[model samples]
Target: MKIDLSEVGRPQSPGARAVNAMTCDVEDYFQVSAFAPYIARDSWPTRECRVEANIERILALFARHDVKATFFTLGWIAERYPQVVRAIVAGGHELASHGYGHLRASDQDRAAFDQDIRSSKALLEDIGGVPVIGYRAPSFSIGRGNLWALEALREAGYRYSSSIYPVAHDHYGMPDAPRFPFYPNGPDGLLEVPITTVRMGGRNLPAGGGGYFRLLPYALSRWMLQRVNQQDGRSGLFYFHPWEIDPGQPRPEGLDAKSRFRHYVNIGRMERRLEQLARDFAWDRMDRVFLPQT
Candidate 1:
């Protein structure tokens, strides 16, 4: 597959560089897919106590690794945990929107998704003091069913998005999409930086980041990221939740077999793997990597 940055709505930077982009979905443990049913969004305020320590651990890890990532915060989270939002900004990380209530893009039409994005962007900007330009759909939910959301994002003043996944997964994946950042021609020409992947036996397996990075062995994850940079000659995007680093979070009740596996498969290894990634690669914020080629 010939990877091009054009469809992602921006030109690639001219020079030899391995880009490592990392982000965190700032939501509490119960907001994840595994526990969404057991815990409703309206009840998120009550669970605020569960996330404070976990976020602290994440901030400390970022400090230790000397890595600066974009925190795609949920509007609900900012409304409840302004202190956490302030600390993340104070720690020198970028703040971006992850939707208002952790709602999936597929669940909403263009209008609803637009409302979510705009609302979330406003909240994050108010709390984080930066121009919110990036978005990652909740659970990578902006798939074929809602590719139209890209246009909404652009119109809402977003410069780029990391919502599409190139690999085939149960929840979200645009398998044949561009593997690198490109100028996706939408309403406002938004940059669609699909999550990183490497082709294997005719399949674009996800290796850039997420559960696969946490569940798999550190060596395989490292190899995949290095391969994305070496073979594609472009920066790779990686993402994880702040809760992923919080090994001590309470396990929600009523999780099915698969949901349990997906959320908690490699909880203990997340911190170690993150440290390894930070040390092995040349990392940069999304803003740094997404600049247009002059």
Candidate 2:
């Protein structure tokens, strides 16, 4: 399972373009980690479900650009909205798992973590009718504290994971982790692809999508990705949530000012920026970009 890092997503021939990984963490606004404190998990079943509509818009956006991306869908959503899972697979996109309940891997012990990954993988594969080999931890939760979770994923039959954010964030990050595709255990172990980051001023700055993609000026975000593509000459992995593009999503009250700002800032501008991003660069699914031989 040892892959030559240099050969990953490299241009096939001279003058060919490097294809970055386009990914979406499929979850609803009510399921966001920050909202977990303010909004009880039990109430999730009753909340207005907008993820189906949002995913429809996302699928349309990808279709317009001819971008075949990855959808790390939640088992909860798939169980409720099987059509969404079928739609993603029908659109020629990769169907991956984002765990069963959006539980942080770090928050779960080894047994619970194993069940989460296994159940989610089985559910997604059953619904999508595609072999699910990829899993992304909720909120990028598989860091140093729970590197064991990566092993759990591998044992659950996942071939790769994009679970570690290599940036210093208040919530979840392994700032010292590699910024590109790497095997956390060994060459034969599961491939852990960290989120894209730009090395600047002696530290890694967030280049991959999330709140940063929405909060930062679109130009600057593009520049960071361009730098990773041009300077480092490596394919970047960018991710966003469906809720990020849905500005009109139900906003829960009693959230802290910081939480509100992070979740809502510039959401209105996201769809436009994403359209421009898809046009500016070549994009593909994580499995195709990193595990091409599979």
Candidate 3:
């Protein structure tokens, strides 16, 4: 599992360009971690489910741009809407795991976390009919306290994970973690790919996608990603959820100001910005871009 970073920034073939990893966290809007306090997990099935239609739109968008991306999907979603998993695979996209029920890795003990990852991986593989080798923790929950989650993923046959975010955030982050992909356990351990960040003013600023991509101006966000590619000479990992492009997703009533804003800010313009992002650079699946030799 020791990734050869020396060849990462280089083009796949002569005259081609280095491609960044484009990923989507496949979960419904109600399943977001911030909403756990407001929306009870029991009510999830009763809530309006818009993920299927939203994913269809996303698939069409990627098709229009000729981009192949990864979908870190939930077992819950796959179970109810198996066709969604089939559609993702049908579109020639990588179908990875987002764990079942959207539980944060930090909140789960080793036994529970192991069950979640293993179950989700098996469910995705059974439905997608493709090997599910990648896993992204809900809300990027693998941090200093729960680094063992990465090992569990490896043991469960996951080759790599993009669950660590190196930036400082109130909800979840291990600010001191390496900004790029590295072996958390050792050279032979699972490859942990942290979300992209750019060094500025002696700190790691969030350059990868999420709510930040929506909150910030698209030009600024694009600049940070470009810096990671051109300045740092590496492939950047960018991610967003299917709900991000759905501006009309149901808004719960009891959410606080911060949670409401973070979830809904600039959502109306997300698809347009994504289209621009697709046009701006080369994008590919996580396995293809990071695990080329696999």
Q: Top TM-score: which candidate number? A: 2
Worst 10 residues of 3 by lDDT: 1-10
TM-score for predicted model 1 compared with the true structure = 0.91
Candidate 2 local lDDT, residue 38: 96
Q: Each model's C-alpha lDDT?
A: 0.80, 0.90, 0.90
Give each prediction's root-mean-square deviation over alpha carbons: 3.2, 2.6, 2.7
User: What is the Cα-based lDDT of residue 83 in candidate 1?
Assistant: 91
- Residue-level lDDT tens digits of model 3 in 122-219: 99999899999999999999887877788788999999999988889999998888888877776676788889999999899999999999999999
Model 2 compared with the native: what TM-score? 0.95
lDDT of 1: 0.80
Any residue pairs clashing in model 2, and if so which?
Answer: none
Cα TM-score per model: 0.91, 0.95, 0.95
Ranking by TM-score: 2, 3, 1
Error of 1 at 216 (Å): 1.1
Q: Write the per-residue lDDT of candidate 1 for residues 1-294, one digit (tens) a residue.
A: 122334533333555666678778888788886577778867766664566677788788778878888888888888988898899889988888899988888889877888899989998888888799999898888766666788788899998888888778887788878787766563347788888888889889888777888778889988888777776666788888878887788777787898888888888888888887888887767877775645
Model 3 C-alpha lDDT versus the unseen true structure: 0.90
